[model samples]
Target chain A: SQKIEQNSEALNIQEGKTATLTCNYTNYSPAYLQWYRQDPGRGPVFLLLIRENEKEKRKERLKVTFDTTLKQSLFHITASQPADSATYLCALENGSARQLTFGSGTQLTVLP
Target chain B: NAGVTQTPKFRVLKTGQSMTLLCAQDMNHEYMYWYRQDPGMGLRLIHYSVGEGTTAKGEVPDGYNVSRLKKQNFLLGLESAAPSQTSVYFCASSPNGQGPEKLFFGSGTQLSVL
Candidate 1:
């Protein structure tokens, strides 16, 4: 079965340190991979999107790298702050259904 | 601007009861979707619409019904609520159905089935 998997356990890191989260998929060739941040009791907000052809995409303090050959995507947050603590989700789109399938997500805690 | 709005921020229903969750968007998006979030399951798509008057089944469509009667509105109906139906429901819309469109989501509706 096609599946998207993220680390289910929460990640903890000190403020100002860099935090990395991984997303891995099996049996699916996605055209696009997207990241979203969801806070407590709120809807997810789009963070970044990286195409299969692109190795990496960056937006300010956030960076995403997609490795199609490895079937994985890594999300990085530099200069992480306590405010950056939230659940991060990765979604995969095959470009055929106009829909995205999401991973279970990684909860990051940036402690001050 | 209210990008996406879901009415009744919270709800509780008994088994076999019926209700409708309303979603509205102001961006005039061409695509709208309903998703339910549960612990350890991520967000599962229930139903989606490409445009007004059109709807399609998604990854998890059983026990749920959807309608896009207006361009800005999408409604999800539960004919007979079940305990398994309890989840945080979110409504999202995208500018178009084309490639790599980002979703703008509503605050979400917390539904509890008893």
Candidate 2:
């Protein structure tokens, strides 16, 4: 079975420190990967997407790295702020399928 | 732009009742999906539609039925609501099936089945 795994633990960091989140998968070779941010009681908002052929993609302060060879992706937020604190989700498109599977997500809290 | 919009931000239904949740997108997207999020669980794909009048089952499609009668609308129906079905339902749309098309999501609908 295809499995997607994100850091299940909540990450706490200072406001100015960079926050890193990891997403690992097994048994699935996805064509594309995406990250989303969600706040309490709200739907997730699209952040960045990196294809299997692409190494990295960035949008503003957010960055995503895809390593198909390693079966992993890393999401980064540089110079993080309190407003950047939210649950981050990593999703991968199933091989030759339209469905995107998501990991459980990691909650990041930035303290000022 | 309204982007993606779902009806009834909050709903409470008794077990065995039936309800339909409606989603509409104005982005002229070709693909629309329905998902359910529960505590400690990532968003689970319930059903999706590639285009109008085309619906397909997803990973967790057993208890849900969906219809895409229009280009911009996707409807999810719960025939016999159960407490296990209570979850935050989200609707998302993508422009095309091309690589890495970002999804536009609605605020979500919270359903509580008692």
Best by lDDT: 1
Candidate 2 local lDDT, B1-114, one digit each (tens) = 899999989999999999999999998999999999998889999999999999988889988999999999999999999999999999999998676678888999999999
Instruction: Please give fnat for model 1.
Output: 0.78
- Residue-wise C-alpha lDDT for candidate 1, range B7-76, written one tens digit per residue: 9999999999999999999999999999999999999999999999999999999999999989999999
DockQ for the candidate 2 complex? 0.78
Model 1, residue B47: displacement in angstroms? 0.3
Fnat of candidates, each listed: 0.78, 0.78
The residue-by-residue lDDT of candidate 1 on A16-112, one tens digit each, is 9999999999998999899999999999999999999999999999999999999999999999999999999999995566899999899999999
Docking class of 2: medium
Q: Per-residue lDDT for A1-94 in model 2, tens only?
A: 7899999899999999999999999998888898999999889998888889899998888889999889999999999999998999998988
| C-alpha RMSD over true interface residues, each candidate | 0.6, 1.2
Off by over 4 Å in 1: none
Chain B TM for prediction 1: 0.99
lDDT of 2 at B113: 100
Instruction: Identify the candidate with maximal DockQ.
Output: 1
Say which candidate scores most in TM-score: 1
